[model samples]
Target: MGRLRVASYNVHSCIGIDRRFAPERIAEALLDIDANVVALQELGWHHRGLSNFDQFAYLEKMTGYHVIQGPTKFHARAHYGNAILMREAAHTHQLMDLSWPLHIPRGCILAHTHWKGEPLVVINVHLGLTPWDRRRQLKQLVHEIQSHRNSHVVLMGDFNNWKPASVMFKPLSQLLPECTDQPTFHTRKAHAPLDRIYLSPGLRFDTIKVWHTPITAKASDHLPIVADISF
Candidate 1:
């Protein structure tokens, strides 16, 4: 059995409460978590002031980790999508496009890595807003994960499920053990739990906690979630 620290976060396009875009602030927040592998969503590129810095690359640089970017949308020179930052180099990776119909472009990023000779798979996803879009994308995610049934999987990201029985999470229940299903949305009000971290039975979970960061009150619309596990 081995142990690892993992975290999932949504950077909200690097926008803060002061209505200013600050990638540095997001990086600082992530540093506080000090996770070995982090799956991040809602990262944007090619913004004016952020010209010289790519959000994903900068975070990796600041944290001294290897990064893998899975772009779902390309705008001019800007690429928007999810990313994975790992303490060790990724042994392999895959990106799936879940751009079904009438949905905001959606995708999932899977990065496979070896830490101390142990195998682990980290999935980073940002699901759709509408029910139909969410349901369809979830199906795609299930199919993808099922194909790798033998591996230890850790699923993390912004799910946007305000309701407990939200159809988006229905499929996930079949494969991963439910850890934390709490409200993580609307930083100021904090009424909804949109972020999540799910682990497979093959892994042992030590504890799980939602990061209701103080900066979260003014950082983004949603608070981050952190989960510590062993296997």
Candidate 2:
């Protein structure tokens, strides 16, 4: 009687193998998972550097969930980054721009939601490609989590570290248990498990799965990771 479903996905800008970008497929994927909350990476906000695509709105409409976007870079062409979606309406949200030495801007979206009257903080982030940058981003993320020590935290996203053991994992390892119950990412050909879902000690995992449906595989280079938890 104490479990919540969570998922993290990199939508590859919502671009599918059909050579088209569709948010609806992403919605369908989420629906299939039936997660209580989801953290998404590589979500595009601006259509062409000036206009906003209803990406978040589309998902919210399809799934009846509240959406919060955390953009890292805004160019004249488009805005891209992470997002947090939840079944319960968020009381408040914060967009932290974790753009570091990498030219590519990375970010995390912190959302506070009331699930069954209990406050929960979900952080959705995409780390940098380089080991050094990811290490730094990890430190910053751990710092951010430490700032709100009293809150229940769920951190999920694409760490992009092919190796299972790395310094990048240390920052979060000290605070949460790594949900390695399953392998995430690379449904196309098992390229590597680059995605992760880390949960704080306050929460316990009830179910962990990798969404690797035929449709999901074509949706992006990575498969989605879902974890059901209870506090």
Q: At residue 140, give the lDDT of candidate 2.
A: 88
lDDT of 1 by residue, 1-231 (tens): 245888887877788767778877778788888788888888875453354357777777777878898878776666778888887778899998988666678889999876556667789988888887788888888888887787888899888677646556767777886556767777777777688888877776687766766665666667787777876
On the 0 to 100 scale, the lDDT of residue 175 in model 2 is 83
Off by over 4 Å in 2: 45-52
**What is the TM-score of each predicted model, taking all chains together?**
0.90, 0.89
User: In angstroms, how far off is 159's CA in candidate 2?
Assistant: 0.7
- Per-residue lDDT tens digits of candidate 2, residues 1-231? 246888998887788766567777888898999887889998775542115675666777888877787877566666777888877767899888778653578888899876556667888889888887788888889889998777788888888887656656866788876555356656657666688888778778777778889679787767898887877
**Number of clashes recorded per candidate:** 5, 4
Model 2 residue 100 lDDT score:
61
Kindly give the stretch of ten consecutive residues in candidate 2 with the minimal lDDT sum.
Answer: 45-54
Error of 2 at 89 (Å): 1.1
Compared with the true structure, model 1 gives a TM-score of: 0.90
